[model samples]
Target: MTPEHWLNIATHGLALEAAARVRAEYLAHLEDALEAGESAEAVLREWGDPHTANRELSKAHLTTREARYLPAGYAPTWAGLGRALGEDAVPLLLFALTALAELRSGETAITLALLLAIVAAALLRWLVLSRQMLAARGRATLYWLLSFPTVLMAMSCAVLASRGAEGWHEAGRLLWERGWTGLLIVAYLLYHFSRLLTALSAARKAEAQL
Candidate 1:
């Protein structure tokens, strides 16, 4: 394949800045080999398969999603913050509203306290992800922290279902009690959890490659 074509395929999923840097480095290497009297075909052959290079490069660099979470400096831009937290924040907000509706009037304080705790956990996650280049162990810890709310919600649903000893019918009732907001929260948390796991797996694979 042509150098341009190979580079394009190899840098497909990387962030823009990372793709540019990889392209420049590879181009320079190609130029140096040409100056040493190597044929273009030989140089390309030495580079191996572009798809293989693409997978390795993707593991080593920040993805577009990951890049959005990286802050510019001491103070991150509003746009960046919004993009990083939008998926998470919206679900948390809905959970808070629905939780308040679910609890009795006297238990409003409990709902508020629970909401604050969840929000704090989420902010801590954002701070670490933005500020640190986490290793696999760190990613594991983050995954558990993010999973806390999901676990709690699942346990609550289980308890509700067990109350009637009616199985799936009771589970359906539980959902009705919480409304669509509950489903959204569960769906978002599961999606986010899977994303974190995928990232952790990628990081481990990259380290293995190194």
Candidate 2:
């Protein structure tokens, strides 16, 4: 292939921000090879197929969907969906049950408060997920920030749970009366939040190596 054709293949998937630099670098490499008495086709052949070359060149500039955390060509299966959504699904089911119970008991305030809390939590979760999506767009800073609110919220919950355990006896009993589901929820949040932190760390490390 011609030099321009080779450059196109190698950079087809690269980010716009990095594409120019990468193209220049590849062009320089080709020029150096030509000056060394190498033919254009030989140089391109040594670099391998365009798709493979593109994958190599684009690693550092890959989006979150293209990163190692998500991988390229990720197909969604029912089992995978279950794994991804199960935690949120459980809370949603519990919320629905609690809402129904409150409605039946005519506790309008409790029902309203529960709905509002659910909405707020869902909104916060979406904010965090949006940050994660930004991180996938070659922004390492957002990946690092992914765990901040989760960690902060988890710590705050722990503190409140502790205070309730010591002085807020009635509230503690109420939580217990919920069959220890509060504890389970707290643990789930901690686990899920930590996983986000871990995934971001891995993705950042992988990108850095590129």
Candidate 3:
């Protein structure tokens, strides 16, 4: 393959800056090989399959999607804080709405406490993710903690499902009684679960790089 075609394949899905860096490094290597009287085809062949190279490079560096979760601390600006808040805004809003709905149903003290706890946990998570340069294991642990509620919800659903018709009836009754509040909670949990899954993938890639 031509150098350009090989590079395009090998750097596919990387951020522009990361792709540029890889391109520069590989081009330099190619040039040195040519200077040493190596045939272009021979050098390219030595580099092996572009698809395998792409996979290895992707694991060693953040892809465009995974890079979205990275804190914008490259230059230290207010943008980092904005990005972090934006990442968390939806989940926090959903939780707040759920708490408000529950409060209206006469569980004043408990609802208020739950809301406060949710807010505190979210703020703490945001602070850690955006401000700290945590190791891969640390990031995975944090994400797992954040995902614990979703895990419990899944287990609860499994238990209910195992109970057959009676379990299904109890689930329907709970949903019917809770109405929109239940929906908001479910949405929040699902969103958290998605983040957890993404973090797990990103963390594994990061650990591979290390």
Which candidate tops TM-score? 3
lDDT of 3: 0.69
Tens digits of lDDT, candidate 3, 104-174: 57765644554455455545556676656687757666645643364346456777889988998988788
Q: Residue 42's C-alpha lDDT in candidate 3?
A: 89
Question: Residue 128's C-alpha lDDT in candidate 1?
Answer: 60
Please estimate how well model 1 matches the true structure, expressed as its whole-model Cα lDDT.
0.67
Give all TM-scores, in the order shown: 0.55, 0.39, 0.60
Q: Pull out the clashing pairs in model 3.
A: none
Report how far residue 121 has shifted in candidate 1, in Å.
2.5
Candidate 2 runs further than 4 Å off: 35-37, 58-61, 67-114, 118-210
lDDT of 1 by residue, 8-112 (tens): 999998878778878999999999999999988898899999999998988777566655433332124555445444536765687688776877655676456
Give all candidates' CA lDDT scores: 0.67, 0.57, 0.69
By TM-score rank, best first, the candidates go 3, 1, 2
- For candidate 1, the TM-score is 0.55
Please count the clashing residue pairs in each candidate, in the order shown: 0, 1, 0
| Predicted candidate 2 versus true structure: per-residue lDDT over 1-210, tens digit per residue | 677887777777555545677777878888899999998889888878888877776655543333434322112454433432343455556666777877877876644554455445444434444333444334333332323344345445665677766645765676688876978866776776665655565456455645
